[model samples]
Target chain A: MFTSKQMHLAQVFLKIFFRDRQSIIFNLLFPLIFMGVFVFFGGESEPINLGLVNNSSNTISQEFSELVEEEPLFNVTKGEESELKRQLFLGDQTAIIIIPESFNSIDETAEIKLLLDASQVRQIGSIKEAISKSLLSIERSLRNTQPMFMIKVEDVKSRPQRYVDFLLPGLLAFMLMNLSIAGSGFNIVEYRRRGILKRLFVTPIKPQDFIISIVVSRIVIVLMQLSVVLGLAILLLDIKIVGSLLSLYGMIVIGSFIFLCLGFSFGSIAKTQEAIRPIVTSFTFPQLILSGVFFPINSLPDMIQPIAHILPLSVIATGLRDIANDGVSLLMINLNTLGLFIWIILSFIVATKFFVWKEVAG
Target chain B: MNIIEVKNLLKTYPLPGNKKDSFNAVDGITFNIRLGEVYGILGPNGAGKTTTLEMLEGLKDINGGSALIDGLDVSNNAFKIKEIIGVQLQANEYFESLNLSELLILFGKLYSNEINTKNLLEKVGLLTKESAKPKELSGGQKQRFSIACALVNNPKVLFLDEPTTGLDPQAKRNLWNLVRELNVGGMTIVLTTHNMEEAESLCDRIAIMDKGKLIAEDTPQGLIDEYASEPIQETLKGNLEDVFLALTDHRLRD
Candidate 1:
């Protein structure tokens, strides 16, 4: 599908991209620096520390303490009630659970007082669910008969996903988006302002061939960026790739195409290099903030979550995350794939409609 | 025989802020350029000289009339015309990151031709600076390199738009010499400029445009004899500048 002329032009563009120090710093080095900062601040996930205070001297309490101790998700420590509360206050423990004296009583209901650290409130829901599951198992065994109502749970095999695992995919998406948009947008505008496009237009090359050359160059750049960023994450940060590399690369290609089309559209609309800055910034800045590149989408306000979920960057980030973290195939993420396709069609239309070979005086 | 035939050529641009209102930039101008000849279009700024050249070069669309280059209609066969024509714009337009040799090779590939970059650079007197990027070259060197880039395809017709507008005297003389050499090599050259000396010295025929209309066209000497034969102060006969002043009734700079 590519001609020798397009290949030659693409090679020239690649040479220019590498020779320009600013482009190198912005596209490659900046992403690595951000990854470094995130890896430093976002430390490895540690098991939750739970302090257990058993006031009941019954078999039920003993069995519960043993069960909690065997769980890998928590570090359980048995101690006095006051000491456990003091540990919780001192941030040594995520929560303190006190088994009341009435826990051994057969007729009366027993209440467990769970004192949790406020700063670790995000773990409250999971901690409560785990504790309740253990208590229900103990109660059914103690009755020595099959319970009339029982809930069956199926465990799906998957690795424990860490914050860095999540951030790596988002970072990849971020780099691709920035490189495609700024690389194409700024370069095209500069070409127009300098009359380079006019110079090329007078040649025998078709406009489509020119644009194809840019796309080919950008795809090559995206591949380079993927290697450096993903390689660094895997080698230095000990990141494990759960999904096939092919799927991740495929998603990246789609994402870069969408952003590149948007860049072309923006490049053709703005008349001067100065005019392009605000236009590109307006489109990219909001996506950067709302796309959940550095954080999870659910962390955003409820009102803005819908908007964030539907953004091009968000869809790309989510798709990469699904494939990288959960080992999901490209076709499995139907909605994300569909969303990206929609963006590609929409942006391609805008780009072709607005793309100009020469700037005409109005 | 004529290699380029232009008849009632017109290009209209919509008036800013009003699409319904428009003005012609090249209004009903008709001219022809013979094979292997240097033709010049002279006028003041905004007289549409550059616009006229652009239409014939197939760089701009023809809004109202027609132009044919080498038996191919420019409007219908724009790409075909581009293949046979080389255009050098006014400004030094090139990729800043690529050296002259690399730019030449890239342009050569665009025309699907295998070219000798060193020979092209040597022809433009920029052979020694082939490794230097466009930004690193001096103003004169840059203009020469632009022409070298245009010649990569061995074009039949060369279009230069104000090639020496911002050049020093030495650079201007060097470029004029290069143009003479190219013309001597049997290349058809078309140029637009406001410089009267350049027109009189280089062009075999001159067309004077004013406010989007052609006022006069003939050999430089023919024009001097026809409209500017009156003797001026300190001179026995008037020159092309006097012809311009007499026909337009305004200075070339105005």
Candidate 2:
């Protein structure tokens, strides 16, 4: 897939990338600065907001609710079942517990339903352990030594929501997106504006070879970027890799290809260096804010969330997060990967269709 | 024997505001160049000299007629023609971070050739400043460097588009010397220029173009004797500039 000419060009591009001060600062240091800001402000721990819906008027159920309210692990909010469910849906509550009507009955096993959002996956073990401990104590107080109640856990598969574990993967995707779009797009436009492309067009160099060179260089840079960001994140933020490193890198390469195609499309369309900035920014800014890079996609307004989910960056972030945080296999994230594949085809077509070697005759 | 053959070459561009209306930029112009000779296309701005060179170099498409370079159809075998031809555009800026030697090597790799960077730089008298980037070189040095890049593949035929347009006298003389040296080494040269002295001193034959049409084609002295034979007040005999003025009826800069 790579020729010697492409390799040579890629090497030169790498040298240029390293020596160019603006490129160094933009591609490498910018992401680190963002990561530092996120860590400084978003690192502080806050008490989890727990919604408690008491369905039973029995004294025992009421007492159990009070016990949950006293627990420091939770900031309990007492509310009606429908109202609390709405809060959970809106991300106001981390989890909700429903105390059934038969809670204090010794003859029956009271099923207490515990509903959690998928974003709170990290806290599941701790939350479940705390609830079980509270129920066991109540069981002891009733003088039935055997287990008297059961907790049924229901996890709402909402958008993969928040914190450093979530933000790190999204940050990785965001960096690759910027590197691909701005790096290739701006560079190609500059080449065209300076007559470099026209000069190359006069040579025996094939167009596909030139494109392959760019792809190789960007993929190499993307790897270096991943290493620096992921290395620092793991060391400084104590982020654990739940999935294979191979899978994570694989997903990142796929994402880099898609965005590079998009960059080429922008490059071909834009005739000058100044004209490229707004075009690239128009595409990247929305994804940066709405693609769940720093925040969850669910936090976006309902109508926008659907659009955000289908964004290239969003799909990449979701894929990387699934692999890195949840230890999900590549196959598990097929839907996200499929979305990226579609983007690859679409952007590739645009890149090729509009590619111009020289200014058209007016 | 002719190395290049052209018949009624044409390049049409649509009128800016109206797609249905159009004008020819290189309107049915025809000329040919013999093997191993320096041929110059002389014209004012927008005479379609560059467009003609571009069409022959396979950089622009042919709209009306056929162009053959070294027996290969230019439109059908653009890449094949590119393999045997070297092109120096009027203006160029190479990769900013790469030095002359590095840029030479990179261009060499594009043709799958192993270039001796020092020898190439020395040929252009830029050996000492080779480690400097393209942006660091002066106007003449950059022009020389651009020529050096065009020579990377050791092409049989070289096309230079206004190679010394913005160069100072010293730089321009240096480039003329370089072009002569390359021609002496048996490479066919084709160039476009607005400088009359450059055309008379460097080119063996000159073709004058005006408003997308070839007006005159002859050797420098032949053109002077045929079109500009009337002795002017300033000099005893006319030069290529007088011939150009007589043929085009306008100054080269205009």
Candidate 3:
């Protein structure tokens, strides 16, 4: 329900946004720079620095430690117990592994102690599982026993979930969310502070018309970011979209709309651009860290897992992955769509209720 | 004929953090602005000049009574009222990176009018800087651009709240000339200012309000004649500032 006037205003917004170098930096270049960094060093680029405090002289333990040193994911460093503990505490190392003196004993029980920072919730579980698997293989080789049991993971979806495939959708979602939240929020606060809204209020333009113009302009920007990130990801990173392209775009559009509403809510709260920054960052940072954007949800801490699953970013990211990487249909993502709609409605209400059209005269 | 009529208009703002204590910013003030004349509301700071202007502009809700613009109730027909009135806010900032021409066109479209951006810029003496962004314009150029934006809708009435508050003397004089030119072109103007000289020279009739109440309303010459009649040391002397000082007590309200 947009009038021609709003559409024209949207065109002006696009002109200004593209012409401003600062806006171009945030809207276009930042996403590309992030994508370039991500593509250059894959998702597992950050090698986990680990310290090995080996007390065991046994050949099995030594062999296991040597095997761990060979993993591409781990950068193993040999150090004394006290020194490694300091490194782990200082966060200079991700984790430290202590192999006890009786680690290779057949008659006595031995334990492998994994000293890790609990705050590194996303990596702790996977790191533990990988170490356990490596040691189990070593124990199996020493015993020279017949094969026991094997576990297999099969992708029930149409496409294989490569690391790039998983990351591409989340990265696209991140870019869209950032553009809508930080981009739209700061713009709203800036206009409000500068009396643009007040001047518009004195004109014949309705509030709805002004908001529609903003949404349409931000949507255009969001689409641009989408194409850039997805194009680079597909062309250079080999991330394939197995689902219908139209369906993927539809999901992205709806997800971006939800964030835009949240942006308005924040814009209503912060009266100036300076105040809006910390407020918006506080809201987006938690979602970025906890909301399965960069890592799988299950790897997070138990208490944080449920909250992360329920966040709007988590739903959007998971939904995009399911449709693009898993070839799922819109109907299959009913819950995610409903959750996002609920958020949109709630945020829209809060935004309109608190929206400051003009500064009140004292 | 009166182009604007206000009747007992009141606006009470709730005291922050205390709903029980509320103060009336504009208390039962009433006045009429004749058609085709510039009306000035002259007051010191915090005298509700802006609050009154906003109420008449249909930007704020009136707690009591009513205001009418061109025979239409402002409270009920605010949207319609907005269509026929141009407003120049004190802080006039538009979308950054848009030159004057582009900004005018966009603003004109908001009112559903096809404005001649170049012609309007030329009329405001901003034709050469039509391509200059708002940030690149000088203070005087920015004020001219703001007035150009206001005129884009072809409004019947123009409301400017402290139009020249932050400008230099040259810019202020330049804006005064623009206001006179616009008024002569048949637009009813309502402006608020604390500068006695501005109100004296630009306004045909001035309403002096203090502490949210109208203290005096008369032509600038009439006010001087009325207030200056009291002989000071066997000599009569009065200016607009003397009239303002004689009427209102010199103290901050709050």
Candidate No. with top TM-score? 3
Better of 2 and 3 by lDDT: 2
- Predicted complex 3: CAPRI docking category: medium
Colliding pairs, model 2: none
Q: Give the candidate order by descending DockQ.
A: 3, 2, 1
Q: Which ranges of candidate 2 are over 4 A from the true structure?
A: A45-162, A356-362, B234-254
lDDT tens digits, residue span A160-192, model 1: 566788888988998898889876788888887
RMSD of each: 8.2, 9.3, 6.2
* Tens-place lDDT digits, model 2, residues A1-362: 68898889889888988887776666778778887877788766666788998989987787677777877767989999889988888889988889887787666788989888777456578767876776567567655476656778654743343377778899899989988886678888887777888888888888888888888888988998789889988998788878899989988888899899889888888877788999998999998999998888997899898899999999999899889888887766377778977888988888877765544111
Q: Rate the local accuracy (lDDT) of all candidates.
A: 0.85, 0.85, 0.82
Instruction: Please tell me which predicted candidate would have the highest DockQ against the true structure.
Output: 3
lDDT of 2 at A317: 93
Per-model TM-score (chain A alone): 0.69, 0.67, 0.77
Clashes of 3: 0
Q: By the TM-score metric, which is better: model 1 or model 3?
A: 3
CAPRI grade, predicted model 1: acceptable
Instruction: Please tell me which model should have the higher TM-score, number 2 or number 3.
Output: 3
Over B14-55, each residue of candidate 3 has an lDDT whose tens digit, in order, gives 988999999888989999999999999999898999999988
lDDT for B85 in candidate 1 is: 94
Q: Is candidate 1 or candidate 2 better by TM-score?
A: 1
